[model samples]
Target: MQNKKNVTLLIIVAALGYFVDIYDLIVFNVVKKQSLQELGFTGDALKANEIFLFNLQMTGMLLGGLLWGIMGDKKGRVSVLFGSIFLYSLANILNAFVTDINQYAIMRFIAGIGLAGELGAGITLVAENMPKEKRGYGTMIIVTFGALGAVVAGMVGKTFGWQTTYIVGGGLGLTLLLMRAGAYESGMYQNLLHNSEIKRGNFFSLFKKWSLFLKYLACILIGLPIWFAIGVLINLSDRFALAHGLIEKIDIADSVMYAYLGLSVGDLASGLLSQYLKSRKKVIFVYLVLSVSLMFVYLFNTNVSVEYYKYMCFGIGFGTGYWALFVTIASEQFGTNIRSTVTNTVPNFVRGAVVPITLSFSSLSKTMGPINAAMWVGLCCLALAFLATLYIKDSFSKDLNYFEID
Candidate 1:
């Protein structure tokens, strides 16, 4: 008999937490010019140097995920979520002050640990608390807010200079602190009296069941590589377009913003379709094939030419399908008891660990050409998503205790 207001507030706050983490993670590349120049890496090969920086920067997501996953499973998810938000938010505030590339890299790494933690912990909070009927829809709302945050950064950069962009990020991060202050721990979490074998908040008790860990291992290994490829494409796309003189800087910003909008739109559709569809497994099977199919058009073709609409279509198919189905559903795949163990797999480490993915895209762009390198990535990994989909099972609204027992 809880009121609707508190639950609504909790969801909103959690969404903001996710949004700002993505803001900091993405804004670096969005405003790459000033930051790179500020760092003092001056030469004909300055562009080459940027490739490494971007790769190093994005790896923070992995560190954050691993950090929060264990903490959320061990400690209270709410507390871990709070810590992740504070640390990463503060990191972005500090990011505005860095005078050099080395300092930015170090801060970004620290920010990443916090950033990754917030993502895993925040998603866990929403999934654990929301009702099953709205769970998939809830995932759409949260990630959509994150995409919106990226859109905000681009809009701000277009109007204001890049330096002020971090100031805005810092302000948003700080404002989120107010929103989170009122967030009460989930009532569901507070009630553990019904269970006998399990203690209310025992860290060691989670792993007392061994089979759960085995299942997690398979999901993590298969998922991380594909996420790595996706991240590479996103980080490189704007830079690739800018380098080729294919579009104006403003148009580049608009394209990225459009991608976010398209991604969020696709998410809404995925959520709606889930209710009418019986087999989420079957839905994902189609999504995987479509994602791979579109990757062919995305990688080999140009998003800048008269073919821009085709690229936009590719985004709708791939970006939306990735989070709406792959990442979003990953959190819901396992039971709440060990949800963190499994769902956090592809989000954090899947793309997080591969520092080389971004680097490879950058190198390929430098060596061959942006579109050609993209083709290589698409052809190499297009069918991989389908292969991974083969092993996936829907974990929708699982019975927590029963999932653990099985």
Candidate 2:
């Protein structure tokens, strides 16, 4: 068993690592318009660039998810955690020096790759270290604190030049690495390391079994609505609000800020709710329903002001707050051998889902307009998410001292 002091330190470091990961992940969204406008994009070109860049970043995350996830199971979670932060921090600082769109796109992609490793590695570490009954609380505290990074991104993006904002985020990430020097690997992983007979970090093994493949797919689908809510409805709130006939211009940064504030609250509440209910599935179901309900309200409601739009952002964010619980379920579903791989890839794949989700929205918006387009795409995602939730087994209180077999 790990010492209480070390476990606590690990959790704190993991939480802060996630904080920086999220800040870099979301800072691009906050500064998208400003950054693009400075590069001479205007009107539709600006929107196009934003989506393109966002997708590029998500693409990087998608690829990075696989790389870092494999590395976590092979190298150690702590290595991936700090390694990812270091890569993204360096990317962010370089991002501040870009003079053209191509340079910006490249940086976003690099940063996305770097951002991919933090949460899964962090959650897996904390989850494995804590006791089964209390592990939810440990993971909950990490995500609840970490989700606030989006709020900080919004504030800093609003107050500083886009370049300065990127620099600040980079600086924060580098500073965070210093605090991580004392972090150690989980006992489960350490044990796995000693058993050379056991195959570890095998990504292809997941696809070899039909049931296991379904389990992996279910974990990925269960999280689709989260990214849709954040990546589409909130990130592009200005477009949706305008389509709904609001004359007042909405700030994307403010929308992201308020939604993340709600997300922070929601994460804390959902985490506590899951612990109290003692069932991860039940909490996920509740939040999914909330997310779907808010999606309807956000899409269909025609009458709204700036304040109402922001409130809707918060409501949607709160509804999607089951993010940490969703990731926890994925971490618990697999064994230690492939646990890090599953944990890391699941959330990033969910984040990566934004690619298809946004692409669909972009295509549909060309004809039906942004509101109805988001409605259709969001419906598809939510329906898939609900089904995925049903498909996956309840994982609360599952013992983590096992291994997947050939």
Candidate 3:
């Protein structure tokens, strides 16, 4: 009974932690126009500054990914859970009072660093603690609940104004810190805690071997389509709507809400399908194909209604909903000594990929126009994701009670 209770507590805390993570991670995008407009940004200035802040936050995640991943493996997952939330919560609260874009950008970068640790550490812990047969469901629950945070951000941003929305996100993170106190470290990590002989948390080790490097690179590549769809297609829904010849304005918040709603459902379905088929690679492949199909549909259909475009946003989001499984695969592929590092870094690297993805999209837009550029970029991401999925070994049923060694 105590064991079950512990599992329940872990799941609850991890889910809520990720919930706050997703909320803080996306709330800025939801409130970008409103918040920036109040701070004196308008027209192209608003759009350009939004991209700048978004890239800055992602840059922080890129750096934080390496920092937290090493800490997770070297210190412990629970430490990351507590430390990341504290830093981000403080940054988020400060974000509420920022008067300038520079202040806002600085706060976001801090918050991004804090946000980078939660999902990866949480997923690593859950993957280690849960039974292998049921681990997919555990991660599915974490991700499904986490995805709804975007929906919550959308609704809350609409109702409370941007400042309060940020405050609420910060408050949620702080609250999760209390709940995190009861969560325990993984036994696998604990076993290695005193083993001074084993080299743990070595980030450079991942790149030193050709095989390990390819595996890590494949794990990162398989996730590119997801961020492209969310970071580019859905976030810029208004521009896409205009390009599609729709006279009515499409709300970016609503697009984010509906797309995340689909993402929640898709996470649940994909996780279950992975369990039933007993294969992560097959499900990812199917979803990548679905994502590609939806991307083309979204791009080629120029005369669609705003309602049709919103549904298309949902489709694209659903198609890219293999996020949890992808992270789970990363965790499963690695050993416990570096499991936290791999799990923690893989998702952030994927999130951080948004920097290059956005930069490429921006450069491509100059020659091909925004819509065509986005379509071309989407194709590239999907192609890479599909090819990478083929290269990664299937990890279902693999025992994880091991360690990475030199």
* Candidate 2 residue runs with Cα over 4 Å from true position: none
What are the clash counts of all predictions, listed in order?
3, 0, 0
Q: Compared with the true structure, what per-residue lDDT tens digits does model 1 show for residues 46-120?
A: 555566556565577666666676666556677776787777777777877888777777877777777676666
lDDT of 1 at 283: 61
Clashing pairs for predicted structure model 3, backbone only: none
Task: Give the Å shift of residue 265 in candidate 3.
Answer: 0.5
Quality of model 2 by C-alpha lDDT: 0.93
Task: List the candidate numbers ranked by lDDT, top first.
Answer: 2, 3, 1
- Candidate 3 runs further than 4 Å off: none
Q: Which ranking of candidates, highest TM-score first?
A: 2, 3, 1
lDDT of 2 by residue, 1-406 (tens): 4499999999999999988888999999999999888999999899889999999999999999999999999999999988999999999999999999999999999999999999999999999999999999999889888989999999999899999999999999999999999999999999999999999899999999999999999999999999999989999998888888899999999999889889989989999998898898888889888888899898988889999988999999899998889999999999999999999999999999999999999899889999889989998998998999989989889999899997
Cα displacement (angstroms), candidate 2, residue 96, comes to 0.6
Q: Candidate 3: count the clashes.
A: 0
- List the lowest-lDDT window of 10 residues for candidate 3: 301-310
The clash tally of candidate 2 reads 0
Colliding pairs, model 1: 64-116, 64-117, 224-350
Candidate 2 clash pair list = none
